[model samples]
Target: ITGELINIINSPDTSEDEHLLSVNFIQADTKGPEFKTTYNSTAQAIRIEFSTLELVLHQGVVLR
Candidate 1:
């Protein structure tokens, strides 16, 4: 399948440059959900995932 070829081309070892991804400003309508991810220091492989939160508390946000 074409998907397999694309995967082979995108394999991490093919690139000398570091790959980085960031997520920001995710909001939810409920409360208290956990957040996490996993990445190897060697950069051989990586996976990232996160769950949406209902209103992440901040340092300066005024609460009613």
Candidate 2:
């Protein structure tokens, strides 16, 4: 699966800090458990949620 990064949002709150990343899958190919090559336009993209603390702990963080 290969996708293009669309957007990233960082929001920190007093209780929970999180990050959200949106990715659009331009190409996908699988042949192991299943065989698929294309996806519907609505299902071709997804949002990935993460914790801001996790990023900070990782040391270096770059978004480009």
Candidate 3:
């Protein structure tokens, strides 16, 4: 008979999810109003940076 060993994840807080740990992938799900606000703000910042890059490219073309 073949059997796979189970690895338990020990933490300070005890819970049922801790017992289900094994040598497998663990997907962490993080979702909330704060996360959404931060993500949207980060995307907006990147968009602003790219828009400035376009200005630099236009300047280079004009300088040529």
Query: Which candidate's TM-score is highest?
Result: 1
Q: Write the per-residue lDDT of candidate 3 for residues 8-54, one digit (tens) a residue.
A: 33334445545323443322224545545545423223211111111
> Whose TM-score is higher: candidate 2's or candidate 3's?
2
TM-score of 1: 0.19
- Given candidate 2, what's the lDDT at residue 29? 39
Q: How do all models score by TM-score?
A: 0.19, 0.19, 0.14
**Residue by residue across 1-64, what tens digits does model 2's lDDT show?**
1364433443555343323444434433343232343443232355555544322322223532
- Runs of candidate 2 exceeding 4 Å displacement: 1-17, 20-26, 30-33, 36-43, 46-64
lDDT of the candidates, in the order given: 0.33, 0.39, 0.35
Q: Tell me which of candidates 1 and 3 scores higher on lDDT.
A: 3
lDDT of 1: 0.33
Candidate 3: regions farther than 4 A off: 1-29, 41-64
> Cα RMSD to native, each candidate?
22.2, 15.8, 23.7
TM-score of 2: 0.19
**Backbone clashes under 3 angstroms, per model:** 2, 0, 0
lDDT of 1 by residue, 1-64 (tens): 2343222122233234433333444433232232222321232333464333234443433343
